[model samples]
Structures are given as structure tokens and as C-alpha cells.
Target: MIQPHQHADQACSECTQRLGLIESGLRGVTPVRFNAAGWYRGELRREILRLRLNQDVSVLKAITFALQRTLPAKALLVPIPSWKTQKRANPLPALICRSLGRTTKTLLKRCRPTVGQHHLSRRQRLVNMKSAFAIHPDQQSWCVSATPTWIVDDILTSGATAQEALHTLKRAGLEVRGLICLGRTP
Candidate 1:
């Protein structure tokens, strides 16, 4: 079931295991882990693009289902960006947002990166992620009118990351509707 506040108490292992399912090409040499913040971990060096191509579709389909039944149109998809090279290594969130955006007929893009929340406390998670993401400048006009906006990610651990994304988008003047992910820790 979906949680109203988009709590991040769920485990990250569920998404990690699913990412490990495909075994060919980039998946064969990478290591995957359940991050403390409830997100899946993986080497982003070369696998980031491949993961987006392979496993991201299924995850996107799932997000589409969740949003279609809950949110209204004009809900733009904003993915929280990772730190620097991290984007090239494990761009899973971006991948899922792109796919789901097409399926849902919404806009998707990465605005900025916030500090990593892996080992931080709940409060630290919030502080570290504050102002961490923004709607792409090109899409700024789309979000200016208080439309519903959703932050998409792979896992929801601690929720610090999504919370920061929500804050950033909202600060930029978008009505953050909610958070969506592939799995929750429960």
C-alpha cells in the first residue's frame, strides 16, 4: 500500500535485488547494495546507462501504474540527481523518470545534486538534501503555475532524499504532489 506522507522507513534491499536480476553486459561486472537511505547502490562507472536501458523499463511501468491511479495530469516528473560522477555510474532514477514520463505524458529531467544521504541521520538527511534538486531551467515555465509535481526514485529509505527534492521543487514554485519509487522497506 501507499503511504500518505511518503515515509522512507522502507528497506533498500528490495530494489537492489531486482537490479541484480539481469546478468548480461553491464550487469555482470557490477556490485549492487541496499543503501542506508533506502536506495539501491551500484557502480555507476559504465553500468549507469545500461541499467537504464535494461531494468529501468519495468520500474517505470510500475511508477506509471501508481501515478495513473492517483495523480492528475500536469504532474511533472523530477528526479533527484546524484553527486557528480555518480550520475554516469548509476543513473537509475533518471532512466526511470524518462521512461515513466513518456508513458504518463509528463516531463522528466535532473536539476541538481544534493549531498549523499547514505550514512546520515534522519535530521542530517533532511539538512544534507535541502535545496538539492531543481526543475530543469528549460522546464521551469511548465512548473511555474503550481502544477502537481512528483519526485521519482528507486528506493525510499529515510525519505531524506525525496523530501529534499520536494522542498527544492516546491521552493522553485511547483506544487509537489508526492513521491514515487519501485519498492518500500516496510
Candidate 2:
């Protein structure tokens, strides 16, 4: 079994709550945010932008290494889809899965782009992302999994994106085992 990998003697409440919502059978691996001022405070945010630019493979390799240290080698990875208008459209979630040598699939597509989540409350986030994803007909086979699969993202703040993705996968006949993320925003 995958032992808890958060701060050993303590657990972040958000992490616990998120895992609970996602249900059991799979695990998550994420590094703590610096939670300080200046550069450290926004490190994760900067890295996310960097990943999307698709210009820093070396940095992504390092970040992916940290992300996979606690995950199972065999679980399939499903990355949340980015908006179609993105110039590069490379998401950190998929890049990390590739780095971990996991079988990764981008099975979902944005049905419509939603507003940014920066100012949204939990319920607002859920509503904003509703029906935001659709499983492309040709990509349907990727979600047919005997082994447990994970829905991954760059960060987990309110978990609205994760929840929506999980539900969308279930609607497509997928049984998601867990949600994984690179960082937990404080």
C-alpha cells in the first residue's frame, strides 16, 4: 500500500479532504508550496506557466521526478485538458506522466473555455467548469482501463477541476481511482 507522503506527523486538511472526495484505490504525490513571500511564494505559479510554454523540458523533468516518487508505476494517467486557444497547449500533468514512464492519455477536450479560477469560490468553480470537458470519440478507448487510472493536474486548490474531470470520465464509462497533483495551493 502507498503510505501517506504528506508532512509525516501532520496532514494538510485540503489534501485529506480532496483524497476523500476522489475516493480510494490510488495515491497522490505533490510537493509543498513554499508559502512565503516573493519568488518562493509564486514558484509553483511560475513553474506552471513555464510548463505550458513548452520551453523548459529540463525543469519539467525535475518536477516530474518529484511528482512520481510516490505513485505506482502501472497506473494510467489522464491529464485535464487545456483550452483550445492556448498557443502551445502543453500541460504539465501530461508531461510529468510521460516523464514517469507511465502510459499517459489525453482523453478529454474542452467543450468550451471557462473563465480563470483565480477569483472563483468553490461552488462557482464547479459551476464554471461544468460540462467543460468532453471525451473525443476517437479517444474513448484510452479510458477503458482494467488497472486503476489517475486524473492529474498542475495544482489542487478548490478541487473543482479535479471533480469535474473525474465526473466527466465516469460519464465516459471510466472508473477513476484517484486524483494527483503537483502542488497544493495555500
Candidate 3:
């Protein structure tokens, strides 16, 4: 089963909680090895950010293994799309979902582009992601099934993106269990 990182601090938990992203009563999972500042300076940050630029099989395998242990077996994984409008602009989330050996669905699409959240404050990130995602036109009918779904992402920072994904899916009448990410920023 997935265990919380021993190094996770109260501040990190508080930060996520204060963002009010998990208020839907769904669990949020992340292995917090370091705070956001430290994570940004580390090699894992480079590896994760470069996933869109390069598809590293070894890194993808390692991340998939780590997340798979924690995710519920019955949850259907729905990847949060990147800011780009192109179909597969960023494959990290979907790749991770596929690697997890679970039922994966691409049910959300970016309705509009938004600034990257890496440099934004929590408020800015939330504002930038506002109405950024919508249910894919082709997937509208898929929402009729009340499957336990999870939003998959490379990292969970301010959670603006995940929150918006959750909002979009719920609005479309899907049962979103919560978010599962490779890492969480303190």
C-alpha cells in the first residue's frame, strides 16, 4: 500500500489543505521528499519538467512503480492535460497512467491556454487555471458511468490544475475519487 513519506512536514500538509483543493472530501496522494524550493533545485525536478521535452523510459518506469503502489486498484485514471491545445502536447501524465497498468481515460481537454504555475503564487495559479479545462467533446457520454476516477499528474504543487480538473469532470457528471501525483510541493 502507499505510505506517506516520513519527511513530510506539517507545513506541507497545511499548504495543500489551506489551498482548499481537497475540500471535496477526496484523498490527495503525493510523496513529499522535499519542499517546493528544494525540489526545484533537485534533479527530480529537471527529470519531471523535461518529460514533455523528452520521454525518458527509465524515469517513467520508476515514477509509475512508485505511484502504482499507492493508487486504488479500482480507480480509473484520467490525466490532466497540459496547457497546450495540441493533442499529446505533454504525455507525462498519460504515460504515467498507462504505466500503472490501470484503466486510463483521456476525458479532459484544455479549453484555453494558461501561464505555467511554476512561478506563480497560489492565488495567481488558481486564477490562471480558472475554466482552463473542459470535458472532451467525445468523452461527454463517458461521464454517464459513475466510475471511481482519479486525476493523474506529474506533481501536485498549489493544486490549481487538479482542482480545475476535478471541477470540470464533476460538472460533466463523473465520480472523481481524488488526485494522485508523483510528487507534492511543500
Give the per-residue lDDT of model 1 (tens digit) for 1-186: 111223332213344334332211111101111121222344221233344556545434433343333445556666656666753545666665665543231233335555656678878877776665555666656657665666666666677676666666667777676675543333
Error of 1 at 118 (Å): 2.2
* Higher-scoring candidate on lDDT, 1 or 3: 3
Model 2 Cα lDDT, one tens digit per residue, 56-91: 545444444434544567777888877745665645
Could you tell which candidate, 2 or 3, scores higher by lDDT?
Answer: 3
Name the 10 consecutive residues with the lowest summed lDDT in model 3: 32-41
Cα misplacement distance, residue 47 of candidate 3 (Å): 2.7
Model 1 misplaced regions, further than 4 Å: 1-53, 56-67, 86-89, 101-115
Candidate 2, poorest ten consecutive residues by summed lDDT? 32-41
lDDT score, residue 184, model 1?
38
- Mark the regions of model 2 whose C-alpha exceeds 4 Å error after superposition: 1-42, 88-90
For model 2, what is the error of residue 132's alpha carbon versus the real structure, in angstroms, after optimal superposition?
Answer: 1.3
The 10 consecutive residues of candidate 1 with the worst lDDT sum are 23-32
Model 3: per-residue Cα lDDT over 1-186, one tens digit each:
112224631123433333322322223343212112123224555556776677765545544444565567877889888876666567778887776778988899888889867789989988998999988888878898777888888777877888889889888888887776655654
* Highest-TM-score candidate: 3
TM-score of 3: 0.72
Task: Return whichever of 2 and 3 wins on TM-score.
Answer: 3
